[model samples]
Target: MAKALHPTQVIVRPLITEKAARLAEENKYAFQVHPDADKTQIKDAVEKVFGVKVVKVNVINLQRKARRTRTGHILHGQRWKKAIVTLAEGHKIELFEGV
Candidate 1:
C-alpha cells in the first residue's frame, strides 16, 4: 500500500451471503478485496467507494480449495482475501440494501 490504489481495484466485490447478510445488521459489511490490499487500504477503499465512514476493518485470507473434475483431475481455486468493514453509525452503503 505504498502507492494509493483506486477504490475499484482495491475492492473486488461485495460478499453477499447468508452470513454476511446477518452481519450487515450490526453495521458490518463483507467484501472480496484484492489479495495485496491491507486493512488500511480496505478502509480507504470502502470509504471512498461507498461514501461512508469506516469504524474498523478486519481481514482474512481465504485458502484455495481443491475441486475434482469430471476426469478426476484436481482443480485449485483462486486464493483471495476477505474484508469485514464496520461502518460508523447512521452511515450505510446503498449497494448492500437489497441491490
Candidate 2:
C-alpha cells in the first residue's frame, strides 16, 4: 500500500522549461515530484492543489547527475521523480496561464 502524502509534499514544484511550456498548451503540465510518489498520488495532489480535474498522470524517474565545478569540486545531484499531468480536455490549470 502507498503511504498518504500531503498535497504540498507530493508535488514539489512546477517544471518550467520550453518543452514543458509547449506541453501545457495541450492540457498537460509537468512537475517535479516526490521520489516515492506514484501516479495515483500525483493525480490527487494536482487536483487538490490546483483545483483542476486530472485525467492522467505519467511518471519518470530521474537519475542523479555528476557535476564537476570549475574548482574541481564534485557535486552529486539528488535523484527525483517527474510527473506529467494531463488535465481534462476542457479544463486548465490557471497557474500556468501567466507563466
| CA-lDDT, candidates in order | 0.90, 0.91
Highest TM-score scorer: 1
lDDT tens digits by residue: candidate 2, 1-99: 777889899999999898998999999999999988889999988988989999999999999999999999999999999999999978998878866
Clashing pairs in 2: none
* Per-model C-alpha RMSD: 1.6, 1.5
Give TM per candidate. 0.91, 0.90
Supply the TM-score for candidate 2. Answer: 0.90
- Superposed Cα deviation of residue 55, candidate 2 (Å): 0.9
Off by over 4 Å in 1: 1-4
